[model samples]
Target chain A: MTQPLPMPVTLLGYGAATLTTLSFFPQAIKTVRSGDTRGISLRMYLLFTLGITAWGIYGLLTGDGPLIVANALTLVPALVVLERKVQSLRRGDDRLW
Target chain B: MTQPLPMPVTLLGYGAATLTTLSFFPQAIKTVRSGDTRGISLRMYLLFTLGITAWGIYGLLTGDGPLIVANALTLVPALVVLERKVQSLRRGDDRLW
Candidate 1:
């Protein structure tokens, strides 16, 4: 039989997932604070947002709680950044980057 | 006892992971082909690279083969794009974006 994962390993996974997921926080904060996304790449964010959505769905289907939690939290800030980026581009404030 | 994940669920997870991970390929291919990263944000890539590294470590520690495989493949192209970005910035070819 396959062995259960050790508690330490599980903890490490949780920690790593949490850290990597939360790493987007600073970027989100910056976007919110500056209201400028001139430096952000619209295509990258668009693709990433879609990718995250797919992963979230996959997680739900697979019953992978870690993936679901990570992607759900990640989507919030990513969407926020994406919305601001679109707004910035529309405003013709591209020079702020 | 907890049941083993269904084969379909596992397949979905693998497929989703592969697609999302491979989604970075076009950007990497573009950067490599054009040797232009002017439109790319250095800070974003830097943070992303670090985040991927952390995830890789987590995957290794947790024995999550999916994470390891995805991130390993991902890091290769990410690093290449990052190198090109730095080079383009240094060469003052910032207008290519």
Candidate 2:
């Protein structure tokens, strides 16, 4: 059996999770609302989404509750932002390079 | 003493770490090279930088090598992007909303 994380450590992890996950909302909202993506990097979002997916899988593999929940929650808005970014690029609204 | 993570688990963690961390480089390079911040969200970068900082501290506290290394490396490019975003906002090159 694995030992439980200390209270402080667990709290900190959750805090970190909340901050990082919530941070995506503003971008997602802005992108969805404005449909602007001039400054968003396609490669960044592409790699980020893939990485977060990996992280989600890693969390699942390890049975990490915070990691799992955080990544899953993060994926939603991240995907939204990424989708908008991709759409903008496809429309030639934004340049890829 | 803590038990070592399974080989696959450790590898997955590093893979996740690598992807997420490297993901920032494109944005950073794009921002620095082009000086464009039209679509970048001020709030997103502000909060994201803070969140990544917290994650780095969390990694240190937990003595997680992958976490520590990943976050530390990620911070550099994250900071660059954030700084450019902030500068753009300050210069009225970008809007807060």
Q: Quick one: best TM-score, which candidate?
A: 2
Scored by TM against the true chain B, the candidates give 0.87, 0.86
lDDT of 2 by residue, B10-97 (tens): 7987788788889989989988998988778778887888888888888888787777788788889888988898888888888877
CA lDDT for candidate 1: 0.72
**Every model's DockQ, to 2 decimals?**
0.25, 0.75
- Tens-digit lDDT track of model 1 for B1-97: 2787888876766766776577567667766765645446565567667778877987887677878989888888778777887888878876332
- CAPRI-style docking class of model 1 based on DockQ: acceptable
In candidate 2 the C-alpha lDDT for residue B33 amounts to: 91
Candidate 2 residue A90 Cα shift, in angstroms, is 1.8
Q: Can you give the TM-score per candidate against the true fold?
A: 0.68, 0.91
The local distance difference test score of each candidate is 0.72, 0.85
